[model samples]
Target: MAIVTMIRRDVLTLPAAELGPDNPLPPLRPLDEMHRIEDRDKEDLPGDMARQIGYAPLHSLLPVRVRDGYGRTRAPRDIDTLVIENDRLRATVLPGLGGRIASLYHKPTGRELLYRNPVFQPACFALNGAWYSGGIEWNIGATGHTTLSCSPLHAARVTAPDGGEMLRLWEWERLRDLPFQVDLWLPEGSDFLYVGVRVRNPHERPAPVYWWSNIAVPEECRVLAPAEEAYHFGYERRLRRVPVPSYDAVDRTYPLNSVHPADYFYEVPDGRRRWIAALDENGHGLVQTSTDVLRGRKLFVWGTGTGGRRWQEWLTEPGTGGYCEIQAGLARTQLEHVRLDAESEVSWLEAYGPLSARREGEWAAVVRGAEAGLDAVLPRAEVEAAYAAWRPCADTEPGETLAVGSGWGALEVLRTGDKLPGTPFEESTLGDAQTPWLQLLRSGSFPEPRRVTPSGETLVAPHWRDMLESAPAQPLTEYHLGVAQWHAGDRAQAVRSWERALQLSTSSWRLLRCLAVADREADHHERAADRYAEAFDDLCQERRDDGESWTAATAALGHEAIEALVATGRITDARAVWHRLHPATRRRGRFRLIEARLLLAEGKREAARAVFDAGFEVADLREGAESIGELWARITDEPLPAHYDFRMRPGHDDRPA
Candidate 1:
C-alpha cells in the first residue's frame, strides 16, 4: 500500500504498487446484481478505502494522478491518496485509512454526484464482463464526473467481496424526475461541481419515492452557502424536531447546528449541479459536500463544528460537534416508495443548484423511458414567468416587506379565506374507519378523533384545529393548517402557526416537513433546512418498496400542496412530498420552471444562462426583480399573460411567447 503523508495543503498521489493498480478486475456484473453493496461500503470503498478488491471493473481502467501548474498535487494534502485506474479508482490514507474517489472520465456539471462503482461497477458481471452490456454509456465533459448510469432493470447494486455489504441504486426507472433528460457535465477549471437530475418521465403515471444520498465529506468543517433564506433545523435537547421562521435571515458565518445526528430535506428541485463543493470556508482545511440531490431523498449533513474556532462559531452550545458526516441520504428502510417499474420510467424530477449563497439554480427533470419529444416536458419560459409572479407581494412593493406571516401559514390561510376545513370535531365519536381519525379516536390512541367545533367565526377542523390544539399535535395537521392560512392570505399568522408547531413536535418527522414549508414561505432558509432534515427521516419510513396508503383522495390533497410549494420555489420540499405521497397527490404541471427560478435566486450565472439559453426556455413577467416570472404566475392571482409586451413568454412553450 502506498503511504502518502501530507502536512500542507498540496495534493498527493498514491503509488500504483501500494494502490494495487494491477489487482484482478472486478468480476463483470449487471447493474441489478450489484445491489448487494451496503451504505457503509459505498462510503468507504472509493475514498478512504484500503482494498480495491471491493470495487467492480469498467470497460477500461485508466490510471492517472491530479496535479497543478507547479506539478504539485492539486488535491488537499489531508485527502489521503486518490488513485484512478481506468473506470475503477481507490484511495488510501497517508497515515489513516481510505479516501473519496472521483470518476476520471465521465463528469456531469450542475448535477448531484453519483459514483457508479458502488451501484453500477459490479453490474457488468452478468454481461459476460462487458461493462456496458445492456446499458448505455455517454461522456458528459472533460472534467465532468460520470453522469449516465441507466439499467435495463432500472436498478443498480453494490456488493462486498465476502458478501458483507450491500446497497441498491435506482433513478428515473419508473418515469419519475420527467419530460427532460439527465445532463451531467462540468465546466473545466470551475471551483464547483455541477450535476443535475433531469425530468423526462411522461405525465401518464407519476411515481413517487423518498429520496436522499449518503454523502461522506473528506474532512470535518463548516458549510458556507447562504443564510439570506436559510431554514435551519436539528435536534432540540436531543429530540428529532425542527423550528420554522419567517422572512428571517441568519447572519452566522457557518451552519449553527452540530453534526451528531445529521439529516435534512431541501424544498428545492434537483437541477443543474450548482455549487456543491467542500470549501474550507474558515480556511480550516475542511471539506464538505454542498448538495445531496435525491428526488425525495433525505438530506443529512453531520460534522463537528465544535473542533475548531471557525466551526465553534457555527455551533455555540456545549454539545456542538463535528468529525462525522457532513452528509445526507435517505434511511435504508425508507426505500420502499421508490420502485423500478414500467409505467414509472417516464416520471421525472428536477433539482436546482446553488447559484449563489442567496439563491439556487433550477433543474428540469424528465421521466426515465418516456418519449424523447420536447412537447412532453415543462418549458423553461413558463418556469421563469411563474417565479416572477409568485414572489411575496410585500417583496414586490419595496418598503412593503411587512411582517405578513407566522412560520406555518395558519394566519395566512385564515386571513385569505382559503383554509380547508379540517374533519368536524363532532364526528369524533364516529369510529368506523369510514371517517377520519375514527380508528385512533375509537381506540383512544394518538392522532384519533380529529375534529373541532367552529367557535364563533373561527372554523375548526379535525386534522387542522384539533391536531393543532392537541398537546402532542399532528405535524401533517399543522402543515395543512399553515397551507390553508397561506391560501387565505394570513401570511403572518401562518408563519407563527408553523413556528409554534415546530417547537411542539421534535420527534415527528411530519412536523419537520411542515417546518420546511413554513420556512420557505417566511424566506428563512436556515430553519427550513433544519425541518427538511427531520422530514427526511419520516419520508424514508413512510414510503418504500412496499407501498402503503395509495388512496386517491389523500393523494389529491398531497399533490395540490406539493404543487403550491414548488410554484413558490420550494423545489426540494415539493419533491420530498411527491416521493412520499401516493399518485393521487402528484400534480402534472403545464410547465416546470420553479427550479430554474430558484437557480436565479442563487446567482448561478451559468445555470441561469443555461435556462435562458435553452431555445424552449423563456419568461413572461418580471416578478419585482426578486422572483422568477414563471414562479410568480403559479403562486398568486396575478395577471401573467401567456405573452407580455415586456419580453412576454408562453407558459408552456420554451419558445418566447
Candidate 2:
C-alpha cells in the first residue's frame, strides 16, 4: 500500500514583490550616483533584444528591476505539499518551493528532525539572493542555493517497483540549461526517507557544475562525520587542514555559543563510504548516508551573535531560533566543480532517518552509536539467522549481508553492490541504476589524459580521443580532447575543439572563459574582448532573469570583462560594465580595486581614495587582503603604513562578544 499522500493547501507566505514596467518603484538615485557611469555608447546593453526592450530600473540601488520582495507579511497561497509517513517517520515536502523537505518528524519522540519555519521568509542569502531557512534544500548547478529553490517545480506521485509511493520533483535549470530531478521514497514501514537525485545535460557539450544537499538543524545540534580533519579557508581562500570537531581553539564537535561564525568542509577519511549526522543535546537526531556519488560533507555554523541572529531571523520567521547546515556534496568540496558531459547524467541515493543514543557522553557516545547503528536495524542474532537462511546466487556478494541487518544500508547495498573488480555491471548505463561511472565522478578521481611512450616517441594516450569519439556529443569528452590537444602543442586545434564544444552548448562559463584566454594568447584582442563581454553578459542575465545571484563564475567573468575592456582602451565601457554588475560582486575587494583603478584613470583622485579605503575595510572579510594591499601600493606608488591592521575587527559592544 502507498504510504505517501499529495495534497494542495493554502499555506501562509510572504508575498513576492511585483516590480516591472507596469509597476515600478519611485525613481530615487543612490548616494553614489555621481560615481555611476552611463553606457553612452550602448555597449552595456544586453545582446538579446527581448531583454533590452522596455528595460528600466525600478530602484536605483538595485541592479535588476524585477526582483522578489524581502519582507515579512501574512498572505495565503495554495501550495502542493507531499506527505510521506511510516510508523516511526512522517515528512512533508513543498513542491512549490523547489520541492523542499518542509518538515521531518519522529513520531515516537514527538520531535521534529528538521527545523520547520512558522512562515515563509525570504532573505538575501542563496545564490539567487532569496533563500528560506529550514528543512532540506537541494542545491545544484554552481555553488550556493540553486536558482530553482524559489521557483515552482513539476512534481508527480508515482509508484515504486516495490509498490511503495514516491514523490518525484523536477525542474529545468534555465541558467545552465540543465535538467535535474529528485525522487523521494518512503517504504511501507521504513523509518528513513530515501532520496534519489539525477542531474542530466541533454546538450552535446560538457558543463562544469556542482551539487549540494543542505540539511538544516537547530543551533544546539552538533554534526558528526567520519573524518579525521576538516578544511578551513584561510584569509587568502586557500584551504588548510584543522582537526575534526576541535581546532583553532574552538570545539566543532559539540555546538558552542561562540560569537565567531565558522564554515568547514570535512574530508571523509574512508573515501569509499560517506555519512554525516546531527545530534541534539539529548543525543537524538538524524543520520544521512550514501555509499557512492555523494562524498563531501560540510558543517556551517552561524554562531550566537546579534548580526548572525538577525540574518537568521530574516532568512526564516522571527523567533524561530537560529540553525546551522549539514551539507553533503557530489564533489570533494563545494569549491570543486565537476564536469557533466552532454547526454550524461549522474545519479545517487541518499538515506536520512532518526537515530538515538544515551546522553551519557554527549557527542562521543552519539558518534559511536551512529557508527555502530548504521548497518544494523534488528538484533544481531536475528540478522545473522536471516543471513544464514538466505540463498546464494550468482549475484550474491558479501555486502549483501547488510540486507538482514539495517533496512537503509541493505537497500543501498542491494542497489549498488559490493566494491570489487570486474563486476557484472557496466558503468556507462544511466538512469536510476547504479553505475561505476557515477562512482568515479562522485569520487572526483575521473581519469585524465596520460603521457605514453610508443616507438621511442612520447605521445598523449589515445584513450582520451577514443572516449571522445565514442561519445562525440559528450561535453566532457570534447573538453578533455581539447586539453590533450593543447598539451600536445596543437594550440590552434585545441581552440577549434573548444569553440566547437561551445557551439554545441554555451552553458559552460568556464569553457567560455578558457576560450577567451586562448584568444588573448593568440593576440586576437577584439575576439577576446567580445568573448569576455559575452560571458559576462550571460552571467549577469542569468542573475537577472533566472534569479541566479552572483557566483564564482560571475566574479571571474566580471573581472575578465573589465580587464579585457581596459586592454582595449575602452575605459568608459569598463566603468559602465562594473557599475551594472550585481551588488554582491561589486562588494568584493578585487572588484573594488578595479573600480578604484577606473576612478584613478579618470583623474578622480578623492573618489579613488574613498574607494580604496572602502576596499581595505572589507579586505579582511575575504582572502587576498595582502595581495590587494600590494596592488594598491603598486598602483599609487605609495607604501601602506606598517601599523595598519588587516585582521577582521571586533563587533560592537552591544552585540555578543
Candidate 3:
C-alpha cells in the first residue's frame, strides 16, 4: 500500500511583526470601497495592459516586521509536511508553501530526485519578490512565481482506487479568479509518482490561464529533451537565439562549463514526446514526463560564477550548493499570452521519478526505460482494476474524500469554503481588497496618471494609510504607503515613509532604491547620491557575503548610483563605483555611453569619442543603441559611425530591452 500522512516539523521561522493594539484581522473592505472608479473603467481593456496602469490596490500594505539578511534568525516552526511513500519512492510536500514538493527521494539508490532546500530562505528573485529556490513550484496565472507561490494551500489525503494513496492540494488563484488542484498518487510497488493537475475557470468570460511546473536539480547536470532551438534572455530581458545543445559556436549543454551565465526558454519541436530529464555525469538524475497537456519545456542556467554563486546563497544558504531549473509549461511557451474560456477546465497528468544512467549515451535509454515502465505499470486495465478494488484506508481523514470509476482517474474536489485567517486578501468575497487588486495585478496593466482621481480624493491611499496606522511598525506597509504618497505628489511624505521603511528593513534593496528615486525626483541631489551609494554598498556586501558574481540587476542599480554621484559633481566617487563594476557590465553599451558622458563632462572629448567608437563596434545595443547613439552624438557634436547598425537583430525582437 502507498503510505500517506501529514506531520508538522520545525523548518524555518521568519521574523514576525507585531500588530498594533488594533485588531490584527480587520474586516475586509468591499471591492468598491477598496478600488477607485478608474479601476472599473479599465476592466474592459486587455488583461496585460490593465495591470500596467497601476490602478490595483496594494494588499501587502499591512506592516509586518522582518529582519535584514544579517539580523534575521532562523528557528524551527511547526509546518504541516505531507509525506507520500511507495516501495520505490518517497515524497514530501509542504502544503503551507503552495503545496510545493519539498522532497522526492528514490528509495532504490537513496538519492533525492529533486533538489530539497534545507532552509526556507526567500530572496528578491520573483516578479513580486520573495521567491524560495528548489523543488517544484506550481506557477499558474501570470508568469514568474504566482501570487500563491508562498501562500498556504488546502490539502487532504485520500485513498486512490486499488488502495493506492493520494495527496491533494487545492487553492483559489486570486489573480486569475480561478481554482487549481494538484493530485499526487503513489501506487504500491510503482517507481514513478503520478501528478494530476486541474485548473478550472468557472467564470462567464474567457481569461488567460498559465501553468508551469518549475523543477530544480543540482547545478552542472545535463538536460535531455527534444528541441532544435532555444531562446536566450540576457540582462534586461534581451532575447537571442542559438541551436540547442551546441549552438552559435558555443556549447549550450547543461551543467555548463562557460564562464558567463545563461537564461533561456526553449520550445519543443511539435509532436515530440513530452519529456525532459536532467542527468548528472554519472547518469543518475530526475525525469519528468507529462501527457499532452503540458507542451512547453525550458532550461535556465545560472553559470558557476561569483554572481551565480551568491544568487544561489540568497535563494538557499551558504554551503548548500546551487541548482538549475527544468520547467514544463501548458502552453507553447511560458504564459503564452493566451486565455482560457469561461466555465472550462484543463487537466493533465505528469509522471516524475529517478532516472539512472551510467553514461551520456545511456540517457535516452533511461528515458525509454521510464516510459516503458510507466506504460506497463499504469495500463488501462490496471487502472480499471485499481478503481474497482479501491477502499478507504484507516489513515483517511474526514476532510479528505474520494470518488470512484471516474474517467482517467479523475476525482471530485470539494471546495473547503474556508477563509484563510489573518489576511482578508485571499477571501473570495467580491468586496475584499484582494478582488480588485488581484484583477489589476494579474492584468499586467495599471491606470494612467490622468485616469486616476485627484490625489486628495484617492480611494486607495486612505486604505493603505489605515493599514499603516494599524501596523505602524511594519516596513512593508510604510513602503506601500510611500508608493501611494508618491503617486499623490506628496514627495516629502513619500520620502519620509520610505526612509522609515529603510530604517526598519535595511537589507531591502527595493526600498532603498525607491527612496533614492524619490530623492532624485525631488531634486535632493546629494541625498539621492547618498542613498544610491548606500544601496550600491549593500548590494556589494551581499555579493561578497554570498560569493555571487555581479548580476544585471545589481549592475543596473550601480549604474544609477554612479550616475547620481556624477550628477552631484562627485566624479571621483562615481569613478570608484564605476571601476568596481564587473568587467562584463563595463563592456555593455549602456555603461559605455555613461562612461563617454562622464569623459565629456571632464573635458576629455577625444577620450569620450574613442569610448563611443569602441562601444558601437562591439555592442549589439539591441533596442537601446539608437537612444544611446543619439545621446553620444549630442555629447560629442559628431555623427554616429557609418558601420553601426541601429536596425533590430534577427532574434532580438521587441521584448524588454
Which one is best on lDDT? 3
Question: TM-score per candidate, in order?
Answer: 0.23, 0.53, 0.54
Whole-model lDDT, candidate 3? 0.57
C-alpha lDDT values of all predictions: 0.28, 0.55, 0.57
Per-residue alpha-carbon lDDT of candidate 1 for residues 174-287, written as tens digits (9 for 90 to 100): 112212222211222222222222222223344332222233332333333211122223322111222211112421223333322233323223462211223233222211
Expressed as tens digits, the lDDT of each residue in 301-408 for candidate 2 is: 665544455456545556657788888987655655567777676767777788665433544455566777766743334323322322121112211110011122
Q: What RMSD value applies to candidate 2?
A: 16.4
- Candidate 2 TM-score to native: 0.53
Task: Give the candidate order by descending lDDT.
Answer: 3, 2, 1
Which residue window of length 10 is worst by lDDT in model 1?
63-72
Q: Is candidate 1 or candidate 2 better by lDDT?
A: 2
lDDT (Cα, tens digit) per residue for candidate 3, span 1-657: 544333233343433221111111111111111112254544554354345334233333122211111112345545556777777887877776667887898887989998878777554344333457789889876655564555567666555544445676666664455566777777667777777777776666776677889999987688877666766654333445567666645555565554344555665666656777788888778878776668778877766544444356545657877788898887544425345787777777777877664434543464456445445544534433432343222223424422111110010111223232211122222333233233333442322222211111112334334444454455655666676566555668877887887788645565677777867766788998988887777767655321222354456577788889988998877887888788756765557777887787778888987886564322212221245546566666565443442422222232211
